[model samples]
Structure formats: C-alpha cells, structure tokens
Target: MAVIDNIHERILATGIAEAGALLDRLGAPGDPLWPSPTWIPMRFDRPLAVGADGGHGPVRYHVTAYEPGRRVEFTFHPRIGLTGTHTAEILPHGPGSCVLRHRLVATSTGKMRLLWPALVRVCHDTVVEHLLDNAEHAVTGTVARPVRYPWRARLAVATESVRLRAVPVPENARLLKAALPHPDLADAYAVRVPPGTSLDPQTWADAIFRNPPPAVTALLRLRNALVAPFGIDRGDASAFDTVARTDRELLLGTDAGHLDFRASILVEPDDDGTTITLSTHATARNRSGRGYLAVVGLFHPPIVRAMARRAARAAVAPRPQASRKVSATR
Candidate 1:
C-alpha cells in the first residue's frame, strides 16, 4: 500500500462566510469555484449534501459529511482502490479574510501505487491548483498568479484527447440524417466540449471552416491540383452549402459530378460536459465516384478528427480581454 496526502489552499481577501458560500455552490450550474469546461466538472447524482454520490471524470466518491457554510468531506469509492477522504474547508484568517483549503488523504494498493505517482499525481496536482485559482478568482475577481500547466500535464491532456472514440451519429442530428437518407458511407467522431464554452454548432462549424488544420489544408491543395487535369471540381471549404440547421446541429454538404457528401456538426449535453459530434455521409454517383470515394475515404477520418479537435481547442481558448480606456478627470 502507498499512502498519499495532498493539500491545496488559497488565501482569499473575502471573509470566511463568503468563501464558504463558494463551497456551497460546488456542483451547481455555473459553478464559480471548481474550474470547468477546461477540467472535468465536479458533479453529483443529486444536489450536493451528505450522501451525494458523484465524482469528476473517472474518480468516484460520495459525500460523507457536510457542514453548511463551512466544510464538506468525501470518501473515495472502494472499487477505485483509493481508500480515504478528501475535504474542502473554509478557515478564518485575519480580519475580513479566509483560507479555502482542499486536502486529500488516501492509500493506494496494487497497480494504483504505480499509476498514482506516474500519472494520477501529475493530473491531480494540476487540477487542485486550478481549483484553487478558481477559488481565488471568485473571491477577488482575478487570480494574482494563475496556475499554468507544465509540459507533462499538457502531454497527459493530449494523450487523453487522442483516445476520444468514434460514436454513432447522434439521433438528434435530424438535419444531417435527412440530407443523406441512404449514404453509401457514413462515419462519426465525438469529442467533449469543455464547460463554460459556447454550445452553438454554428460557432464550432465556423471555427473549423475558418481555421482548418495545416496538414489537411496542404492535403486539400494537393488533391485539388491532382484532380484539376481530370476536370473535377475542387473540393474546398467554399464549396460546401448549408443544407439544414438548428440550434443544436448544422448540416453542410457539396454536390459534385462524382459524389455528393454531407457533414454534420452536433452538440449534445452530457453529465461530464457537452459532446460535439462530427459526422460525414457520402454517396457515389457512378463508378468514377466510387473510385473517388475510396481514395478520399482513406484520408477522411483523420482529417475530420483533426479539424474537430482544432475546433474544440479554438472554442475553449481564452480570448484576449478588451482593453479598458481611462478618461482623464479634472
């Protein structure tokens, strides 16, 4: 068994009552304390209270104790091989100030002992620091020095992104389904859209169209040049026409002499975060179209996956804060 104890704390200029109130709002919509959309959100089966069962991401835990406006404790689920408790508490500091602290105490057995130090610890440290930064930002409207992820943490996050799986085209993507009723080929990939980001499918589609992956752009140029001699129309972003749309889904397609294709962008809410699914459907118009489809299909999945990942990153990226202009006063 490997014993583990971790603690993260931030001194807030706000009073104990104010800091405690932040704790009370944990797992609530628009949660002001736990960093989200960028990180897995803290959630429970029901409203936060003693016995509330939920944990962010793969970790499982249940609330064991709760003191309104003061502290809360959670014990890790035994099945996860983490036997211990984690607590969030607000402690009074000096006048008009308090400390928001999160501490975790657990023992790891078997493979967890190896996984904990190698992978879990790095992610845990980064997450806890981000949580503290969120607490500070909530209390003071800004963090004095926000936590930045190191290279290792970035690598970990990238690894997770690469593991995203292909999912069936969402049933709610009615527009895309309607456009290609019997497509010869159909594929879909899904990625989680971080919380606190826009859920608008149009916004995501625009992001992808405006800024495609560099490799895909290069490949498209080469494809256009090669097919030019055959009098084939260039396959480019500009050629796509919007077929149908709603708040949750956007369908875009293009018709060519060889093949007709449609692409769907769908946004659906999930317990952990919002899911964005990108689906493709295509129909070959002739034998030549079948040949074209086979060639294009080889490259389609990766290119679509890359574009989807890029769009997700662009959506979550922090926009530059508008500069404030100060006027001179007499």
Candidate 2:
C-alpha cells in the first residue's frame, strides 16, 4: 500500500544488545512509555511472533512479521480507513552502539482522511517521541533530550478534558455493574499481561491501588507535601478506600466532601496473561458536587490512566526493591 503519512526517528544508544532488548520490551504490557495517559494502551495476545493478534484500544491488528531483538511489524485489519504496516526496528551501529527507530506507514481510504490527521497523527507523533525518550533512558540511563509537547499539542492537552468522552464498558465489566448500581459516568482501561502471573485479581488490586510501590508512595508524599503549603488535604498511604471486594474484583472509593468516586479493577484470565481493566464512575449529589465534577473532568482522564498504568505494571511484575546489592566478581 502507498504510504499516506509516516514518522521516522532514530536515536543513538549505548549498546546494540540493550537497544534490541528494549525494542522487545516496548511490546510488553507493562511498558511504562506505552498507553500514554492521553493515548491508547497496547498489547499482544500471545508471545511476540508472526500471527499474534493484538493492538491498542479499538484498533486491532495481526503481527505480520517478527525478528527477535531486532524488529516487529503489524498489518492492520482495517479500522475506519487505516490500513498497512507499523513497525518498530533496531539498527545496530557497532558492538557498543545502535539506533532505535519506529515507522508507521498507512493510507486512509475513507473517513480516516478526517480521523487520521486530526486525531491519530497528532497523538502518534507525540507518542513516538515519548517512546524514544524512554528508549534513550533504558539504553543509556539518560535522556539525550526530554520530550516536550509543541504549543499546539500543549493546547490540545489543556483542552482534552473537553474532547475526551467515555466508551462503553467491555463484556468483562459485568461484575462492575453489580457494585455500581447507578454510575453517573463510567470509563474503563485495559491491557494484556504475561500469562500465569501468581498474583490473583484481588491481590493485584490491593498492591496497585491500596498499597502503592515505595517509589510511587514517596512521589505521592512529596506531591502532598508540596500541596500542604496551599492548605490542600491529601489522602493517607492508602490512596483509596475499598467499598467492596470479591474473588475477581475489588471496588475502591474516594469521597471529596462534595464529590464521590468509585472505581474497580476486574481481572479476566485468558490463555495468554490476564486482561486487567480499571473501571471508574463518579457521582455528584449537590450543586457543590456538580461544580467539583466540572473541575475534576478536566484532569480525570490522565489521572485514571496513570493509576491504571501503575496497577497494570504491578499486576504483571513484582515491584522492584529500593536497595540493590552489588557483588564483587573474583
């Protein structure tokens, strides 16, 4: 297919092996850079290889080709007018250096002409830069340059609260309905993880939201501390309160005097890893509550996404320890 729009970026990295490893890691469910707060979360149904089926959000695709530690490409199944391939590749420079690149080439045949540029392209460009930023950090332990949104992108973000709209819950959310009888508003986010993770749904929920990792805890504390000067109150170590719990799902709640929030994490096991979805709903009972809701909407998407990403990361792997021991080799 002829290429309609494509983005190519190359960044120097410390080691070929490391860069290649990072390329593979980028496809994992827990990748920190992916599923950006403002972008769709991505995953593969099975191990990275040809024929694996998966894609981000509503966009679905099948892996067309794969080369371990070197590259992977996908051919979309036609969503709207989006067709063609998106590939992530690693080009080694020498034993000690390499270049990491991501290229998306596709043609929009229908409504995509309107959707692709206005929506996908804008977000894709920013997301690629972010991926590179993450790659540099993973390969060299330092970012050559920090990722920054252009002024237009920044404006889009500031107004995203207006553009953001909730999509219907997936079939797996049947459990959530039993808990949230009448949700004023509902939204959900999900990602695929490695199969057979020992952590159960409830256990993972507790660790991710109820008890955050040490690093996240410290960061939250620092944020709260900074807000203290402005006389703003902060939640305790347990950022949320559990309203209800069952074997496969846990409902968490938060009360903001005027506004009330309820969210849950439902774990659905599959042949591949578990698919974890963070679903949430908010209610406003009074005029003051309605006012609060209006303000909260502006930042709700990113906030919920950040929480989901943190939980997804924890669900797939154990949290890293703060201290590490270095052994002396004889």
Candidate 3:
C-alpha cells in the first residue's frame, strides 16, 4: 500500500490549553467551536477519548490516541478503499497563542486514490477552513466570513417535487375555522382522513388546540434529522404566524431569512365534504435568495403535507375526555 499524507495548520490567538481543548472536542456532536455544517455534522456514540467509536454517516472511525488538552487521533475505516489515521494537535506558538494542526496520513491503494482527489479533497479543505475560522472566532469574538455552502457541497441538497393529498373533515370545518391563528399545525405530519367519518368537532378542536398527535411529532423529528445535515435552516415553529384566515382558507407566514414564504391551506366545501389543498408561495429578493429558496424547496412539499395532514387529523380526530375541558375555552 502506498502512503499519502496531508497536513493543515492554523494559528489561533489563544492559549495552548484552550486551543487544545477545542481541538480535542472537534467532530463531536456538541462542540460549539467545531465547523459542523462545513462537511456534515459528525457524531460520536461515546465521549471523546481513546477507544471511542464514531463518525458521520457511513464514514466510521475509532479513536486511537488521546492526550488531554493537547492531541487526539482517529484511525478511520472508510466505506470504500482507504485506510488512515487523522490527528488534531495544539502546540504553543508564543505566550498566548498556539498552532492547531491536523495531519491525515493514509494508504490508498485501489480506487481511493482517484476518489480522494475527486470527492474527499473538496470536503477536507472546507472542513479545515471552517475549523480555522471557528478557532479564530473563539479566540477573538468575530468570524471573518459567515460560512456558506460551497457549490460542490451543494450537491448534498437535491431538488424534489412535493406532492401531498389533504384529507377533509367537513364536520369539523367550523371548529377548525374557529381555531384560526394556531401555528403549530404547520409542522404536523399528515394522514389523509376521509370525509363523512363520524368525528366530533369538539374532540378534534381539543386535539389541535391542546396537543399534537404522537405520529405528527415523530414525523417532525424525522424531517429535522433528514435536513439538519444539509445545513438547512428550518425557521422556528413559533415564527410561523397566521398572516391570513377566513371561513374557507388559512395562510401561515414565516421569515425564512432569504425569502418571505407562506403556506396556504385552502378548503373548498363540497356536497360530500371539504377538499383541502396545501401549497407554498414565496418571493425571493435576488439570485442568492432564489438559490436559497430552491434549496429549501426540496423540503417544502413533505413539510407542507405534514402540516396539512396534522391539521386535518387534529380537526377530525376525537379529543381525549381529559383534554375536552381545556379545549372548550380556547
């Protein structure tokens, strides 16, 4: 096996102990100073120490050595054809500064040599730049530039069309209309409930006003986990406000940073029941804004479905007796 080595270093204007501690915690889930979104958020199954086993996604590694407030190294087991050890260390550069260095030494014999240059190098360089930026920010309370996703890294996001079917609850339409301005529905997981089912309006109101269904909560978590790695900012649920509402339609708006977006839930009453349609509208300010919107567009469909389904189910499902009293006043 032939060997390939890469070394990257940065000088942080901080004490050795501080820099070392930060270096030690890199690649863990809760390290505030690590450049998490640069590549992907890395998570360890255990605490940072020798013998800990963890990595992000399919790239697995084991901690090989550790020196408190100084250095830590990992021997990686790549998903494909690479064997290596990567180390991060802090060395005193002066009275109150230190050099943080990362060294990657590996043997790549087969397809890994070709793959490394094509895929891994871009990711590696970005991660290193982020680490340095984060270190500098910790030492001095300023980040030189806000991190943006590289064009290459943007491949992590895929454009997907969203399709959702809204279930109607005609009996509870009146109840739902009364419960307007309830923003939590925007994040719920949807299930298509058929119309004409004997569902109590009060019960459905209680479910919506008081608490979300467990299935909806699970769906929200799944969605968050799916998109978090891509560095997508899912604006806070509380930020979703009722911008417009009427007897037949409701509009919820949220500040998505790059764009002003709204989710519209249109309800049409028919002889059989009501047909609900969940859709999204946005106005991007510029090209960057449009790009941001496009990235977020990948998630908009399923999320809208979740919101509509949750609202539909909550507006039709029977509320528990214990929560009925609480639902009546709200």
Quick one: best lDDT, which candidate? 1
What are the root-mean-square deviations of the candidates from the true structure over C-alphas? 5.4, 11.2, 19.8
Give the number of the best model, judged by TM-score.
Answer: 1
- Each model's C-alpha lDDT? 0.78, 0.62, 0.55
Backbone clash count, each prediction separately? 2, 1, 3
Cα deviation at 298, candidate 2, in Å, is: 21
User: What TM-score number comes out for model 1?
Assistant: 0.87
- Candidate 1 residues lying further than 4 Å off, grouped into runs, are 159-163, 240-243, 313-330
Candidate 3 wrong stretches, greater than 4 Å? 143-150, 156-330
Provide TM-scores for the models: 0.87, 0.50, 0.50
Candidate 3 to truth, TM: 0.50
lDDT of 3 by residue, 1-330 (tens): 568688877777889988877776765545655543223346676788888887654567889998988988989876656688888888789988988888888887577788677866555655565566667677766654433445554342111011135443333333233443332222222233333322332233223323555665666567667655545455455545566566655556565544555554455544323445544456664555576556655665554554454556434432222111111000
- What lDDT is obtained when candidate 3 is compared to the true structure? 0.55
